[model samples]
Target: MKRYTKLGLILTIIVTCFYVTTASAQGHYNVLKYGAKNDSSKLATESIKKAIAAASKAGGGTVYFPAGKYLTGPIHLKSNITIYIEAGAEIHFSDNFDHYLPMVKSRWEGTDVMNFSPLFYAINAENIAIKGRGLIDGHGKKWWAYSEVHVKKIPTSRWQEEFKRLNKDVLAPDLPGWIERGFLRPPFIQTMDCKNVLIEGITITNSPFWTINPQYCDNVTISKVTINNPDSPNSDGINPESCRNVHISDCHISTGDDCITIKSGKDRSGRKANVPAENYTITNCTMLSGHGGVVIGSEMSAGVRRVTISNCVFDGTDRGLRIKSARGRGGVVEDIRVNNVIMRNIRDQAIVLDLQYATTTVEPVSERTPAFRNIHFSNITAHGNRAGYLNGLEEMPIENVSFNNMNMDMQTGFRIKNSKDIEFHNVRVNNKKGPVVEAENVVGLQIDDVRSQKPVAGEAIIELTNVEGAIIQNAFPAKGTEVYLKAKGAKTSDIVGKANHFGNVKTVVIQEADVKEKIKLD
Candidate 1:
């Protein structure tokens, strides 16, 4: 009798504990409790969607996923909900094309289209988040095999027929592009026109396209995210297009394309959208093995302004701090600043600001021309094949740029062409060959306290061609210099020297007799 009484008391206590726990977790909906299987045998997409629906119906709650492997389709997020994946959970998206049916409105490569739904998608959502330490695996091997032609092992009838099922007539302007470029891959996560967004503490890998893309979002924050998608084509990491007031920090990215690309859009579509990516701050990030680190568009059509990037490290990237736009891309990129950055093993130029990225025929300055101004770089150190390259269009020259406290070790030196109001201060280049500074078709150029560490013989320390209004002040040329300054262009005029100490140079200010009157010494 006593033993039976004790067993009843213990059962009652256990029931009380469970009831208390259930009552406390009132607004939390777990996927496992909603018939979600952990094993990979079955599709857990329906059950997970059910959980999301339940959470939404309950006046906005948390949809939780515990530690397990779950296969699923696209996850469509609603407002005022957080999809929290526990530490060891894995959400593996299936690669079957049919799973991504009923095409959604999205932007691809800076153009609007009705394309495949992104893996995690939200449109016009407010106060949404996807947080916690988990894995989002986009199994894109088969998709890649299909996207790349000439190695097409599968029939085009599958994806082609799926696209044909949609009414292209309704999707105007998006029709011919969509019809021509059939079945483009989707991004890993995309939020369109969202506000008060947050994405934190997630490790994303194997994305099909641009990973972590947010379009036209305001007050967005992405922190502590790890993105690893190497050798995958067009897989840019953290591309925020036409977004404002964005904060991106503490990210470790290694991708096949540019790591952290900022864009307003491309060509006509971008101009029509008319939204500029502005008020952005990016810091405390490390990038590895990308085409470029912190690149701002070859596709900026609307504009880009008020961007700040600091305290970043670029290791083994092709280029660092690249800003490229072409003639047809009509935009104004300005008020940009970059400081306290380190770059190593750069294959190309460390700094690139080219206005002729696509090389169009010279046309009159109109709405199709792009402009770059008011950009500054400071406290930068790099080692690369070339230190810097700045190429502006002849019609619209890049203007009002400055570089201060720069230290670079390069095989080649800096090259500038068709620019205006350029300034360099306290710059040192340890070049193995060539002049430290070379200019062509430049105006209002200023160089102060600039020197080459390892100056080679028979090469001028500074070479100028077609330059006007040039000022050289406090320039200390290095040893083994043949000529300190060479001015040869017929159009060059108003070359002024102020307190320039050419102590180690063999000759100072070697101007051709035809243009000798243009060179001035003070």
Candidate 2:
């Protein structure tokens, strides 16, 4: 056994040496050595491309950028290459729109189409990485200023005529009207159809669109990255669309849009692609001042599944853990688990599941019907939020959601509608006005060990409308409350309550105008 162990150890050392020697032989190509100037005045686009090409010709190597400001345009990445920016190095993208000429096959707002090239783009590449503690500054003020001010300066008649001319085959049929009013902005870093990707220890700021967007890629990792894009419209931090097996951790993001958004596709174009974004693990992230801390989508048309988020902090965000979709975007979002999240000073609902995102008209349930199910949250704490809203569609209800061990201090409590199979365990809420918990058109609900503190007068602690098969046990209502539970609608039946501590409650009223069956309360 000892002889065999010695032989194995020798083999391992030999293999390690061979790998190290091969990696050394590949060599590193410095941008400055390839006619790339450190002075930020000159355009280093061609020189940087030359360096990348030289490294690629040498059979996959590293393209190193030393400590200087390299002003360049769009950089198209190749396979088996690492763009290593050293400390104090900054790749400042030029504001020249013509530099990113020749549209590429890309997705704009969930639709598959040809658009402007991203700042750093890669297609069908393998073993690619963007590492080192440097900055990638997108001079986005020029792009944003053009969209914000110059587009509005066009005459109304000319704008309408231009819209009519450009709306055909160039854009998706179901594209929103607002997107057409502005110039098409490109993402900062977009890698599509790539595998084994890594983006770490970089600070990205002032993005024209999304900061880091990886679409239709597999085995991606983004860690210890900082994104700062404040006051820029649609400047999302990191958006992973139609990707699989992604792990994002230890990221600090503050953006104008959602900090982290996961999507598949949008509308009919997305359903045709049929590639779901699945198996994501997001942890140890901090989000600030965005639309949502971690958003699923307003554009998930294919599907999203098996996402686990934990140990995240969201501060000053509009919403936290938001899942939004609408009709005509047929998809399924399931098996999402979030835990150990802390949120503070949320402007809107901290937790929202909104199915009526963009449209309100009732349409037929076809392949465009959206479905959400099997979502679970635990150990969540939030303060200074308006309320928790869960509004599902009547035709297709959100199903099988569970919340455990939650403590929230908000202006209002839960307002749930059109859902089924919901369970809340050890949940506590302190609200100012309205009922602590209100349900409409809900079925199969179980509330165990739930408490509401300092509830206002004249409002019932729990109000139910058209609820069926509800079992509420061990619930605690605040003292001096007028009513404990109020039931309405003809479908409200089989409501069994036991061991509830209603302090100084006056009556439990059941409106008999629409109630056909008597509610069971013991």
Candidate 3:
């Protein structure tokens, strides 16, 4: 009888503990009563900090930000914690830049500096999440206006001239003191060297610079988040730099700069750092008022590789898909695959692959060089105002570029310069029919099933200048529209194509015969 009573007591205790643990893990850790000695509306920054501290002391819990304008300065996020701002809650940032001053380690323009601290930041924290349908307003218009004025005053040529006179032996611009003057402000959520982070369903707006920038993080997923920041200058949506295994999806971004940018590092400072931003997947996103719908690097000296972007839409953006880098940036961006893209009302080219960025002047190029290669764009539909351009630097003509099943309605056809080993399969570009295809300084070109609405004034569907081993195979007229191949000094003997094979690149017009094998449909 005594033994049975002891067993019953033990089971009762076990059941009670299980219930307590489960209940503790699933509810809100309200900050109303966490040592707020006075009122909640008063200076409760210390009280909220204490509440978070108490939660951390008890092995991590959700720090709930209730409904109100909770004004606070920088809040440091701890590990094993999730900050859930309720549906009506808003955590407003303190406006004074001096409040976020006294510099922390952060990255701006691919270089690490000790400047303005981020509003909500963490370093090396695991299992962290910022999830809820709440607002994180940066209140950064005052700072953004100041920084833009600072950048505009300092021109590159003027800086170059000043550096030449000041320090004759210096190669790069010596701007340590200039940078120290607090010109470049940091982002809102600048988490450095963190792991296992997820930011979902939150609306982050009004950033001083780029909205959400996670530098040197791994295993991060940012989905269903709406980033709305338009007033501020250089307000990029999400910039994941030098990170790995990232997935960003279902986000609507409207900003002043590039909507989503993938970068590694920049210039001599970035190349010396040696961290590559790789292994990212972006899908189901919409962008507005940005430089590119999806962009990779004007500042990637450490390289970007193995990126896949699909099922995205760009409306009223500057360019649909842009890959930009400069001569001094010695990096390789390869293995990029883009599919199922719908672009409309784009101001510039539907797709641009340019090596010389931010320059109109022509300079010498070299072969021991940085270039873009192995890029595949398939199943894309675009309505563009101008012609798409594929410009590779003189030394590094973009290699192994393939375009399959693309349908474009533009004012002009596609133009290529200084690129080699290019292929266009089933590409139909409808325009006023001046020059359907133009290629300069290319090698080993191929065009199959390429058709246009009007007759190209130039007799060449393939116009090549300084090109070698160019081939135009299986191209024919469609709907009374003419097809021609023009190459200046490029041999027609090297080209091969059936005349009936020319039509629309999006759909096949020519049926396969004995000599021409049907490219297996995928």
Candidate 2's C-alpha runs over 4 A off are 1-26, 148-175, 508-512
TM-score of each: 0.91, 0.91, 0.83
Q: lDDT of each prediction vs. the true structure? A: 0.87, 0.86, 0.74
Model 3 earns a TM-score of: 0.83
Worst 10 residues of 2 by lDDT: 154-163
Clashing pairs in 1: none
- For model 3, what is the alpha-carbon lDDT of residue 114? 56
lDDT of 2 by residue, 42-68 (tens): 889999899889888887889998999
Residues 1-522 of candidate 3: C-alpha lDDT, one tens digit per residue: 999999999999999999888867654477667643222255456666776777777777788877766777777777777888777777777777667655677777786655567887888887778888989888888767556444555334432343234333322312233343235556888778998888999998888888778888998899999988885677889999999999999999998889999988776657777788899999999987787899999778789999999999999888999998877777889999999999998898888898877453445654214589999899999887755788888767888888889888887778888887888888888766555678777777877777665554434444555556555655654554433544343222243444554343333322223213222221
lDDT of 2 at 191: 95
Model 3 scores a C-alpha lDDT of 0.74
User: Weakest 10 consecutive residues, lDDT, candidate 3?
Assistant: 513-522
Better of 2 and 3 by TM-score: 2
Report the Cα lDDT for candidate 2.
0.86
